[model samples]
Target chain A: MEKAEILGPAGNLSSLKAAVDAGADVVYLGFNDSTNARNFEGLNFTEDDLREGIEYLRGKGKKFYLAINTFPQASNFKDWENSVDKAVTLGADALILANTGVLKYASEKYPTTRLHLSVQASASNYEAINFYKKHFNIKRVILPRVLTTGEIRTISENTDVELEAFILGGLCINIEGRCYLSSYVTGASTNTEGACSPSRFVDFSPTDGGGMTISLNKITLNRLSAGEKSPYPTCCKGRYLTSDGELSYAMEEPESLNALSLIPDLIEAGVSALKIEGRQRTKSYVGTVTGILREAVDSYYVNPASFAVKKEWTEKTRETFEGTSSTLGSYAGK
Target chain B: MRDKMELTLGPILFEWERSEVLDFYKAALTLPVDTVYIGEVVCVKKRSLTIKDIETIGKDLEQAGKKVVLSTLAIVSNEEELELVRELSKLGFSIEANDASALKIAKDAGRTIFAGPHIKTYNKHDAFFLESIGVKNICLPVELPKESIKDIAQNTNLKYEVFAFGKIPLAFSWRCYTERTYGLSKSECAWHCKDHPEGIDLRADTKENGKKAAPIFTINGTSILSGKNLSLLEFTEDLRDTKVDALRISPQYKDTGEVIKIFRDKINGKINYKDSSERLQALIKKPLTNGYYNDKAGMEFLEINDILNV
Candidate 1:
């Protein structure tokens, strides 16, 4: 069996260092700007941080991937182009991008640099993935969190381009590249603006019934009883009245994507890399996930027949799972 | 003068009965709009219409003096659906591809293709790439601000279209929200989507004494759209000021001819922007929103006066 890369997310210098130490084959991070999806405060790297981080990774014999993944508006075109130029100048290994325009520009201007399609592009099937690969020379596609493990196996068989599957993190119920629920509520689009459930527009108020009602831009997203864990108020997970007029979790229950149990199957299906999806997380998260996945991958390869998933593996990672709920997501959906 | 700008009716995102669709387009064929797009672009499982029904409707709509276009699914999952895409491309009209998979197949078939908004072409480079690959016309995404549309239109030679009316398509998913909401499996559900012709509205509860629950989203099968409809009636002239070739009207479950007429009159300068917008507003049930055109939240409604000065 070929070795699969354990890719980790780096929110800052500490997380980058932690990933390297924890056995990350490659670390993907973003600069401190709206171009990155996790454009949160006190997160992401500065120019100097990126420069030194690249040096540190090079010295350690690991790779750095720049995530200039947000879609650029016409007014922000120059900024996206400049970031592509900067990534190459800094000796970054590859760029994970979403916008079709940005991909075309990078493929034309810097032909040698590797371009990985971001999950935001939502290329689920072989033909869509091949379209990106054929037109832009995209080297890899980070599959959306909406496919089954069997589906991934079929797609890998059809396409020669590399496939990067999300192993663990906050799972988006709606496909990442197409969703605009956050933009409707807060004027921040995941596709165009790179902010979904932007924290700035969220407001909390004490309900008269003794629970708290969470609202985004004044529309109550959810009302939680005291001690009820408040999951991220994504529009898809929110309870809505159905056509039969019943209010329930209309799309999905709030959960985290944890593929630790399917590591052997995913690898056997020909995934070239496993991606850990949290650039907004703390260093502890980056370190812990990288370590667990590293161990799991190594053990599975060292003795494929003897390898079994230990309960402790999921228990350790479930500490950070969303709403204390974990799922294989569309990879194992009903 | 630029030849009277075309008004095209986009594919219906709802799952309507065959009779309802045929009658709706029967009326739509005589409307002020110059083109009528006929096909099922949403769930392939919604078999309310057969290949024969589509063929008859396509022939009837063409005979009724409207240019007909067949649209492909926004997301293709299996080989059967890909085969369906090729079948649609072979039909005697231009193909409107909502997914790149369909785009590639259409290009291979040497069909005249129009790119759908789901392609997410944001700038001149992407638009030019679409043109390079045999797309004759491209509908810009619903979430794009006006400046992006203006830039792409000005910089590219490809004909462009904007969502002039109806609910904005926000996302597409394989899991059906309606089936899950009803606690029924995908195969077991008894066509509940037909009940919600305009889609089920999702509202946010409010604590304010005088406020109503704000309708935030509408789910019609696999496509999730804005609860409020998007209208560019107030800015038809402004859109025309740019290089935009046409304004696309995504059909709601209403008598669309009246809405299409309002847009045509507004574009022809027969009615003032305010009066036409007021009339158009009176026809649709949902609150009107045009925030995306002005770089605000998509569910927001801003006036021409407010966005023009910016």
Candidate 2:
């Protein structure tokens, strides 16, 4: 059996180099536009930046994947097509796409180009996975963070495509590519604009009790007491009052997904690659996470039965996370 | 301009008792709707109405001179859900493919498919792609603006349906919020969502100094919906001009029959836009919004005159 690959996120040339230097087998990034899911301003790469980043990865004998995952607008489908053409021209190892139209264009125009389905596609079951494989010849699929390890094993047994599972990073409570809450409150479509809880609509005001309240589009998402850290005002992680007059985190709390202890189970479930989320994070995050996960994967390969998570690794990864806590997410079977 | 448009009743998104489910469809047989979508589209754990029950309902609706389409789950994460979709495809009724997995299963079985809103048909290319795969009709995504809908309708020959009324579905998650709120695990949820057939209203105190609570969203099991009902009755003229073939009304817990009657009257020009809009507002307790149709924040309530002037 082949060793699983450690895929890391890189927003710029510096992060790309950091990930590569820290022993990431593959680094994924996106162009600086709404064509990608993490379409935040001042993040992502320009054409010049892509050239440098790709060069850096090739020098280190590592691979890089280009993410063109957002659904293209009817008025400007050419923008997505142009990105596909550019990615192939720039020698991307694979194209991570979410929309069927974009997948059709990439497959027909560049038949030999390797295609991988992005998690944003939300293709969770084997039938959906096989559909993409049959149509576009997708080589791998980044599984959505909704399935348990047992379910992953069942899907792997049923489909012939390689599976890439998220092992670390911010967790999306809602299924990817299907959420419209951000657009509901802010008028910025996460599907088209590629941003959720966009920064322009976010406001933080100090209260009389010395605490702060975070609002998205002037709609309060949460009220933090004094010394309590506030998570990003994404609609899902917000605390709201239910019909029963109780205020609580109705969707999900602010917690990152850490699957360090489940690495062996994931490997046994036939996951070929382990992906770490957060391309919008800093370079140090990319470096530290990649290094720790790299050691974990290596240790598992060395001695499968005796492999165990180190306390230092969990502590280091937790320090770089968005929230103070971490969860096994759906991988633990509800 | 198109003079006639069909009225479609979307599948029940909330959990209801089996008897209540049958009673609703039995009453739907007498409504003015032209087509009725029946199935569990939100969570697979919902087993109030079995496939056998849906088949029985589909037959009765068909005999009553209404087209019936079986809707699939919006999220297919496991083999159990996939098997359910596969079984649904085998039934003789036309299947409404909510997820790509259902789309594949139904298309492969040679079933006529209506691409549901969750399929993400944002561009003409997406519509064309689904059309090429034998999809005959498409329900546009909830967040698309009027202009984009016009562009797609102009480019594709497929029948287009817009979500014209009811609470807009916002997001779906694996963790059941209904179970989470009750401090129960998903496996042992005990069907608590049945307690709130209309969904649990999620509100927040947006005002800094006021004690008023503003409704934010509606938690329905694993899915979240916009707190306000989306009523496009005032824009019937505009939608007619956009060349939409159908308008969909998602089933609410109560007053759905009255809501359907008002929309039918407006479509037939018996009641004017303002009168129909006023009646709908008075009928439902929740507020109404049309911001998504006007290309603004979906939670905003845009006036009809303001939309027309723009």
Candidate 3:
């Protein structure tokens, strides 16, 4: 069995250091703004922070991947293009990008820098994966969660590019990045705007009756009992009234994916790297997930048959899980 | 100058027999519409017709005094679909850019384009941004209220198009719910979607604590259309006053020409809005709805007189 790279998300300088110390073979970070997917306030790296972080990782003999993955608006190609140039100039190992325009530009300007396709592009099958490869010379693709393990194996067999799979963090009910359900209800789009279920659109109000109602853009998403905790009110997870007479999760519930148990299976299926999501998380999260995945990857290498993952491996990953809920996600082929 | 407003028949979205599609477009030439956007805009795996068939239809529509534009698939899942978009662009005809990637290619080719509603142009800022990117026209998302559309239209420089009739396309994706229903993988879907041309209707049970609520229509992986088709034939006056440049009527499995004629009479002022609306409703084989236009919950409907007061 070949070794699989353990990747971690770095929201800031502290998280970057923690991820490195915790055994991250490669750490991924992004600049603040739409150039990266997690375009939140007070998170992500500054230019100096990126520079310092890269030097630290290089000294430790580790790799750094820059996420310049957001889609580029027709007139806004400059911001996306400049980030790619900066990533190349800063000696970053690779770029994880979603936009075709950005990919085309980077292939022309930085032909040597490895290009990994972001999950935002939603390329599920071999044909879609190969399309990106032929056009932009993408080296690796982060497979969308929609695929089953069998499908992933088949795709890897057909495509020339390496494969990366998400092992932990937020699980999107709709196809990641391709989802418009949030934007349809809240006016903030995840695709171009880098914000889905934007915080401003969410409001939690106590009902006159004992519970609290979590609303997104004035539409009630879900309600909780007096003592119950209200989940984040994203449109996909919202409780709604439909035409056929029902009140339920019209889309899905808020849950994080914990795929530690499937690490060996993914490696067996020819996965090149393991990605841990949630760049908006704390250093504790980055450290914890990176540590566990690192051990699992190393164990799989030492003795392939001895690499049985205990429930505790994924349980350790659960501490960094979002929304206080976890699922095996699509990795088990469901 | 043309005296009549351009009526564009949206491309076929379902898998119909190739002969049926050819016959439909051939019959569409006699209608008073101005333009016809031909070709498939749904699943890429449907290999019923080739690009040559679309070109022949475009020629026939053009010879019938109607301009023709080819539409690419809405979801560009893989390389084959990307090649379809590239081929459509190389055809040297007007194209409707559905996805952002399509818009990028259309802009690269410097082709004048109609931006599909799926592109998400919400406010005046977005409209202006798209206009700057060379989108000559835009179809507001079906879920947007008429007031927002009117407000944005009043401020933006780009032409606005409204969904006048047909089953609204609420969403699209790489997963084929229709195939998944039969316990089959999307790759080996067997083109099962060819069986349901309108869409296979589904019901969701949203009961919590033993209370019954309205069940919403859940269709394919891509679309969650309203139980009722969007009928705006009766509101042509209101739509026109919003300064909308055109009204887009999506093609269904049947009676497309009659739907186009009813809207034509209303837009031409040949009949009153009420009379035109009643006749249009009577012509439809199914229930009609204008919920999204009224800006209420997507499934709710309002009286025409009440809509006027609002």
Candidate 4:
């Protein structure tokens, strides 16, 4: 079997270099516009910055993928169309798209540029996966973090397109790109606006008891005890009073998903790429996770029969997340 | 075109008893709703209604000269569910694909389809693609503003539907929030969602002191819906003028029949926008919002607040 490609998030220029230098075979980045999922400030590349990043990746013999995955609103779809055109001009290896209009336009205008279905499209089964492969002729699909490894294996067996599974980082409590929770709370959405719990709508207040409360759009979402690292106020992870009036994390815990131990299993399931989910993290995190994943994949390919996750591999990445705990998530949840 | 706008009752989102489910449809038989979307669209585990049961209901509804649409799950992640969607498509009714996977099966089987909101038909290209396929109608996503809905509704020859009432479905996930809230797994969830027939309320405080406020969201199995139901009773004129074929009312746990009557009156011009909007509030006991119909935050009533940093 061919060695699985290790993909990393390229939030900015330094992060792009961090991912490439740390041995990422492919790096996915979004433009400065709010057309992609990680609509954060100072996080994505300007058009010029994207060109520079592509040049850098080409110099290192690596691949570049542009994610223009947000659904364009009806009144102003020109921006999304323009972004797809720019990505094709930059010679991106593939375009990770979610919108129907954007995907159709890209396939027709830039016939040579390959297209990869974004996880935001929420194509979880062979039928949906193959629909894109047949209609848009999608070369790859980034599976939403909702399927078990067995289900992944089954879909891979049924569909011809390459499968990319998320191996590390934050998990969307709701299925990718289908969620309206953030927009309900703060008027930002992963599907339409390419943002979830955007920082600009967040406000932190110090309580009289020395605890801090994080609110989105003047609504208290989560409260942290003193000295605790206050996480982003994503609505799904927020602690709220349940039906019986118990204050708890009613929707989901603020835990990131870690699937490192499933590397060999995923590879055997015919998944061609392993993607890390953080496109909003700093360069240190982008670099370290990319480096660790690179080592793990390389070592697995060297000795596939006796592959195992090393103790050092777990230790080196322990503090990368806030909770220091990870979940196998739907991979095992099913 | 008909003298009145078509009224569609969306899928039953809550897990009611089998008897209650049957009774809801029987009562709906008399309501002014033209189309009733039957079948499971929320979680696969909700056993209140089965494909066989929906087929039975479809037969009765069809005999009564009403339209039936079998709605598919919003997040279809496995093969067994795909098998179910495939089977449902051939049940002698139009298929409403809440998931894109559902669309594929319906298309392959040569069935007429209604592209639900989860399919994300945002532009003319999406509309054209669905038209090329067997899809005859596309339900616009709930968050679209009046201008955006008009942009497509007027431009495309395809029929369109708008979510006119009920708690707006916000998101869906693999892990059931109703089960997870009680420290139960999805498989072992024990149907805790049935206890909150309307859904467990979620409140986000307006002040920093962590004070109590009205519920802002509701947790029902894997589905998260708005705390308050969305009522577009006031927008009937504009919707009809724009040639929207249907006004979808998501099935609520209570007063669904009453809500349907209110919209029906509004559509026929028997009631003015202000009078009907006020009557809708009396039927459903929660705050109402039309912010999404206007270009503003979804939960806000009129988006009177400043666009703080957004």
Candidate 5:
């Protein structure tokens, strides 16, 4: 059986080096702009940083992918085109794109560059994946985190394009590209602006009763008691009051996706790569997650029949999570 | 002297009973809508109307002198949903492609495609690409401003439409919030979404005092909608000038016929903007918002005077 390549997230030069040193076969990073999904402040790479990181990865014989995944608006469409131009010019191993406009430009402008359909495109089915492949000569597609392991197997059987599945990190319960909860509150859009519940609009204030309230654009998302670890205030994870007058996590409880046990199933399902989501995370997090998953994959390949999830791997990944707990997400089924 | 813009009744985004859906379209046939989009665009689990039912409804609407378009599921994850898109595309009605899977299937079947708002046509380049693939009309995403719509219109000759009214669809999740709120799992949902014909109102407490809670979002099965309705009745003049081809109004549970009439009257110059705006405000239960049209938050409401001035 062919081993699935372990793909890691790299926010900057340090995270890139950390992921490479921790045995990630491929590391993906984005420009410090709205072109990528992780367009947060002080995150992602500068042009100089991209050049230096590419050189370092080339030296280490590791591959790097560039994400220009966000949908481009009419006003700044050129910026996306420029990012595509720059990424290909920098000798990126692959370019991950979400918008059809960007895909058309990249495919026509640079016909030789490898293109992976971003999860933001929300192409969850094989037909959609094949559509991208047929139109742009897309080489791979990152499946959304909404499919079951069985469904992934069925899709793999149908499409000839390579499939990449998310193995770890922040879990978006909503379909990525279709969601507009962030833009409904803040004017910024995750689709167009690549910012979801942007940190600038998020405010944390202490309550009178020694609790803290997290608000996005002055709308109270959740109120945490003192000493409670608050998850990042994305609209989907927030607790709200239903019409029944009960306050609950009506959408989803704050949680991260940990697919450690499903490594064998995903590989058998024909996933060519396993992606660890989170370009906004620190280098320490990038290193720890990449290292743990690397060990799990290696152990599974060496002796598939004897492979079992080590408790220490799960515990170590839990430490770097934003949510209090982790789940297998949609992989195991609802 | 541009031609009068048409009004399209978008597909039902909520889970209504079979009889209710049939009755809704039966009434829609008498309304002033030029085109009627019928089919399920939300959760596939809520199968109140089957493919046969949709075909019957489409036949009835077309016989009533209305162009009928069938919409596909917004998120096609499984084979069951993909088969539905294929089946609908072959049904011979015009197809509204909500996802790339549907878009490709419908186009391959030689069905004229209407790119739904979820297809992400943000720029003229995106619109041009869709047009190249044989999409006849494009319903711009709800987040775009008037300027962006005009920008796309200026660059492309394809027919353009904007979501003008109803609870704007905001997000979708794999887990059914309706079931989760009622303390049930998605697998055992038992069709609980039919209980709330509109949707469950999700409210948040006000910042001024924790005593009052304002409606923030509407939890409809797996999808989320804005708590308030979006009305562009006051901005018909602005829309007319943008050279848009049509205005889409998502069918709500109540007063849909009246809403369609009001838009028709406003578009035909029978009712002025103020009277039509007031009439719509009185009909809707929640507040009205046109913030997205002005390039602000989707939930924020811009007053009539403020919108016109801009």
Candidate 6:
């Protein structure tokens, strides 16, 4: 039985320690710049902070992957290039990228840098995966959440690159990086800026019916009763009344993707790494999930028969911070 | 600047029948549009029409004195889609690259392509970059303001295409909103999009479903479409003055030719802007909105505050 590495997020220093303590073999993080996708305030690390973070992780004998995932616009390409150069200068283990042009430039300019395809690239199948591998020397590809375990198996068989799949995290209602819904509703860019259904454009108004009305730039997203949970005000996940007079969640409800049950199957499908979703999460979230998954991965590899969807796994995961109540997403695969 | 603007009929984005699609092009031949993009750009599963369908439509449109372009899907998720895009690029007809992967493949194939509106080409730099990659015409993203369009049009050498009439595609996604709405997965979605020919409109959500409380414009499979059918008839004169080479009219559920004729009359200076707008708005099956072109947010009507400088 092959043991896949458990990757965790470290939004800040405390989160980094938590992830390490919780048993993450490798931790991924972003720098506080436009280069990384999660370009949020008070999130990500500075150069000195990254250096310190690297040292801290090194002391724990863990690996660190620096994410520089945003596709650079024509003017911003230089900024991204500089960040990649800095990441390399800092002895980062790997670079996660989505932009074809950037991948090409990096592969040609710095051949030694390990490149992992970001989920934003939406390379779901073998041919798309092969294209990235052939052109930019991508060593691994992050499978989008939309794929099934069957799709994952087919994709893994077709590609030589290591496959990483999301086992836990927030569900992106849009197709990975292919969504323009966020940018269209709000001027902010989700692909490059790393903010989805950006917070700036969303607002909550008290509906006449006592529930809250979630609004994205003044378009009423949904009207939830005051007692009903008001989801994160994303443009897509809200309920809609279609032209057919049907009222339903037209896109997806605010839910977290929890695939702990699929652990043995994911290993069977030849996934090299199991990644957790939230990067803007707290230290507690990073530590708890990382520790739990780390143990699960170990137990499964050590004795497949003894490994089960333990009740404790479910309870511990539920205790961790999630966008919604945990869910086993659509990977019973096509 | 040319006094007469060219009208480009953008590709039929939905899954229309092969016969209906053929009939659509034959009708488009007699319409006021100078160019037509014909292909299956939306769902890969909706294969009611094939390459043969595209070839027949292209030949008929070309014979009818219209330039024909083949369009690619906006969100290419897998190998099948990439292969489809590559095949589309190889077609002798002009191509409209909607997503980045298509643009890359088209560029690599050395084909002169039309950069579709969904490309999100925001500034002069992005425009210039597209032009460098052999993009002859660039459709402005729907969310762009009039001023931004004007600036981009004036600065870029490539021809600019704006949405003139019909439901502007606000967004495209991997998860089919239609399937999700119907409680079916994307693979099992039963072509329910045909049910709402004008696309679905998410009304004001008065009932908030926790975390799910947001204005939803569910179309097919996680795809949230725009609430209002985009009406730029009032802005035709402004568009004309901005050196816009073409105005794109997307084919909707009904009265598409009539909408084109109304735009033609406005563009030819045969009708007043307000009357043309009113006529077009009345003809549309859905409510008219100029949200994207206006500087205001996508949903609300633009309001002028009295406190602004006179």
lDDT of 2: 0.90
Kindly report which residue stretches of model 2 are placed more than 4 angstroms away from their true locations once superposed: B1-3, B208-211
lDDT of 5 at A204: 94
By summed lDDT, the worst window of 10 consecutive residues in model 5 chain B runs over: B205-214
Best by lDDT: 2
Over A121-162, each residue of candidate 1 has an lDDT whose tens digit, in order, gives: 878788888999999999999988767777788888999989
TM-score of chain B, candidates 1 onward in order: 0.95, 0.97, 0.91, 0.93, 0.96, 0.89
Model 1 chain A lDDT-worst window of ten: A239-248
Question: In candidate 6, what are the lDDT values of residues B1-310, reduced to their tens digit?
Answer: 4757888888777666657766777788899989998765677777667787677778888998999888888766566777888887777888888776777677778777898876756556568767766789988777667777877788778889887666557655656666656777777778876665556567655544553333334364345566556677776767778888888998875788998999899888899866776686577634466655665545444422221221
Q: What are the per-residue Cα lDDT tens digits for candidate 4 across A109-189?
A: 887789999999999999899888878889999999889899999998998999999998888877887888888777776
lDDT of 4 at A296: 94
lDDT of 5 by residue, B130-217 (tens): 9989999999999999889999987899999999999999987778888887788777778999999989998875534645566889
TM-score per model over all chains: 0.95, 0.98, 0.70, 0.96, 0.98, 0.84
Q: Measured by TM-score, how close is model 6 to the native structure?
A: 0.84
Q: Tell me the docking grade of candidate 1.
A: medium
**CA lDDT, candidate 1, residue A102:** 88
Backbone clashes in candidate 1 total 0
Residue-level error in angstroms, candidate 6, position A130: 3.4
| DockQ-based class of model 2 | high
Q: What is the DockQ score, from 0 to 1, of model 2?
A: 0.83
lDDT of 6 at B104: 69
* Tens-digit lDDT string for candidate 5 (A1-334): 7789999999899999999999999999999999999999999999999889988988999999999999887789999999999999899999999999999999999999999999999999999999999889999999998899988999999999999999999999999899999988998899988879899999999998889999999898989987777578988888888777788888888889999999989988889899998898999999999999999999999998788999999899999996468999989976
Model 1, residue A279: C-alpha shift (Å) = 0.5
The fnat score for candidate 6 comes to 0.36
Model 2 chain B: weakest 10-residue lDDT segment is B205-214
Q: Judge candidate 4 at residue A324 and give its lDDT.
A: 40
